[model samples]
Target: MSYIQQSFSVQFEYKVFFTEKIFDTANTDFANFLESRAEKGIRKKLLFIVDDGVTKHHDYLQDQITAYFENIDGFELIQDIIVVPGGEASKNDLQLFYWLVNTLDQHAIDRHSYVVGIGGGSVLDLVGYVAAVSHRGVKHIRIPTTVLSQNDSGVGVKNGINYHGKKNFLGTFAPPAAVFNDATFLATLDERDWRSGMVEAVKVALIKDAGFFDWMESHAGLLTQADPASLQYLIRRCAELHMAHIGGAGDPFESGSSRPLDFGHWSAHKLEQLTDFELRHGEAVSIGIALDSVYSWLTGMLDADSLDRIIKLLKELRLPLYHPLLEIEDDQSAIVAGLEEFREHLGGQLTISLLRAIGKGQEVHSIDLAILRKAVNMLRDKW
Candidate 1:
C-alpha cells in the first residue's frame, strides 16, 4: 500500500440577490456583481439563455438586457440572447441540451466566460447542467424568474435534466457564480404557476420552522390571493430556510441518504412523471405532503391535531391533497415502484422524511405499505 493520498477541499460561496427589474438601466445590482468579478486585464464574455415563455410576457426583455450591459466595463455581452422553450418539457429534450452546448461552443464560451440562465427551474436546470459539463465547468449565473426557482431550486447547488422520463435522472452538484432573483417576473405567472410554487414554503416550514408554519397558516387567505407582501415574505423565508439547510447542514452535495429538505419530494417526483407533467411540481408535492402527513398520523409519529392543522392549511391554500395516480393498486403499481427508484437515487437505504410535529421532521429508513395505502385512501376519501 504505497501510494500518495489525495486530499483537497474547495469552498463554494455565492449570493442570492432579491431585486425588481434586474435588467433595468437604473438597477445597478447586476452591473455591480459583474464589476466585482471582472479580472484586471481579461474581458470576459456573457452568454444569456432566456426562457421563451418569459420573452412572450416581457417582449422588451432582450433590448433591456442588452442596454443594461452596454455601459458595464470589463465584460462583453453576447448580443444574440438565445431563447428556448420553458417548463418541464425543456428538461426532457436531449437535443435541446446538446443544441445549447453547441451554441456555447460556437460562441467560444470558455471557463472564464459566464453562462447566465434566466428562467424558471426547468430551464435553469438545463442551462446549469450545460455549463457544468462545458469546459469541465464554466462560470454560470442564475436569474430565476419564478417563485419555485427563486425560493428553492434557484438557490440550491443541484443542476440536472430529466432522462428517460425520470425526474432529474442526470445532473450535477454545480454551484452558480451568483443568483439574481427578480420578483417582477412573478407578476406574469399564471395562477397555477404562482399557486403551486408556494408548496416549497409549506414543506420547509413543516420540517424546520414551526413559527413559519404558523405564519403561513395565519396568512393562508392572503397567500391564496397572491397578495404581494405575503408572497414576497413567503419567497424570502423559504429561500432562507433552504439556503441555511444547504450550507449549514454539512452536506451541500447530499453525500448521505438523509434528505430532510425532500420531505414530500419522493412521491412528488413520481407523480409528476406519472401525470406526464400535467401537474406542476408544487401541486404534486402538495399532495405528497398531504399523504405523508396522513401517514405520519397513522403511524403515531404525528398527533391528530397537527395533522388536522396541516390538512386545513393545504386546503385553504387551494393545493391539491390527492391525485388518482397516487392510489396504490398493487406491488407493481407505477407509484409504488417509485419507492425503489427513489431509494436508488439516494444510493443507500430508502429514507423518507416524515413530520413528528408542525416544525419537526424525522427520517425513516422504511415505510409500511399497508399504512401508506390507508393514508392514500384517507386523503382520497376524506380530503
Candidate 2:
C-alpha cells in the first residue's frame, strides 16, 4: 500500500486594541471594533457574557452594553447578558462549559455572530473555549477586565479550563477574533487582583528583557501603589513582549517542549491546584518565580545579586514570594510531583526554563531533585 501526504497552512491575525470605557456609546472603540467587519444592511448578533464579579462591581454594565448597541447599524446586542461565576471557579466546573454552548444555541448565535467575554482571565478562557468549540467556532472577542488578563493571558491565543483537578487540563489553541483590553475595568479591581496581575509582567521581564526588568524595579513602588500611568505602561509593554514572543517563537501553539515564557509556571500550576485555586494565578506565579530563582542560585547558574534583585523587586511590588504549601511533604514529594505533571502536560521530555541572568533564560531537560529540595528549604527559611 502507498501513503499520501498533504500539507497546508492557515494565516492567523487579530487586533489587540487598548481602550477605556469600551461600552460607553460615546467611546466608539467597541462600536468601531464591530463595525469594522460589518457588511452593508447586515446586522451581526452579539452575545455578551459577563463575569459575576464584574457585574457585582458594575451593576450598570448590562444596561450599558445594551444601550451601546441600540440602533447601531452593524450589530445587535442580545437583550439578556449572561453572568457566570468568576475566578477559577468558572474554569473548575465543566458544567458551565456546556451551559454556555446551550445558551448560545438558545439565542440562535451562529458562526457570524459574536461572543464577547468580559471579565478576568478565567472568564475569558471559559468563554473563548465556548466560542471556539460551539458550532465549529464562532467569532469571539475578548474584553479582558483584570490587569493580568489585559497584560498577558488576554493577549495570548491559548484558551483553557481546568479538568480532573489539573491546571488547564482541557483547553484549545484557538485565537480570539479580537482582543480589547479595556483599562477602565481595571479601576474597580480589588487590591489583591490589582497587585497580583503584575506578576506576569515581572516573569516576562526577567526572562526576555532585562531593561524592562530594570524599569519594573524602578517603578515597583508605583505599580504597587496603583499608579495609573505606570500600570498602563506596564500592561502595554508586557503585552507587546508576549505578542513578540508568540510571533517569533515558531511555536505559538506550543507544539514543542521549550516553553520559555512559562519560566515559573510549573510550580505555579501545581500550587494553584494544591491550594484548590485559593491562590490567585499571579500570586502563585510570584512564588514560582521566587522558587525557580532560588533554585537557579542553588545550582550556581544565577548570581546572588541577580537573585536578590529578583526577590526584592517581587517583595517591593507586594507580591508573595513564599507560600507555606510549597514546604508540604506527604506520601510523596508533593511539590516535586509538579515536575512530572509538567512533563506529562508537555507530553514529552521535561523542559523547564531557568534564569541565566536577569534578562535571559536557558532551557533544561531535567532538574536535580536534591537541589530542588534545597531551594524549597531555602524559601522556607526566608519565610
Model 2 superposed RMSD (Cα): 1.3
* lDDT of model 1 at position 263: 92
State the lDDT of candidate 1 residue by residue for 342-367, as single tens digits: 99987888999999999999999998
**Index of the highest-lDDT prediction:** 1
List CA RMSD, all candidates. 0.7, 1.3
After superposition, candidate 2 runs with Cα above 4 Å error? 328-331
Candidate 1's TM-score reads: 0.99
Per-model clash counts, in order, read: 0, 0
- C-alpha lDDT score of every prediction, in listed order: 0.94, 0.91
lDDT per residue, candidate 2, 1-383, as tens digits?
A: 89999999988999999988888878998778777899887768999999998999899998888888774887788899999999999998899999998999999999999999999999999998889889988989999999999999999998889988887888888988899988888999999998999999999999999999999999988888899999999999999999999988899999988899999999999999899999999999999999999999999999999999999998898899888888845426678888899999988889999999999998989888878877888887875
Task: Name the candidate that leads on TM-score.
Answer: 1
Residue 188 lDDT, candidate 2, scale 0-100: 94
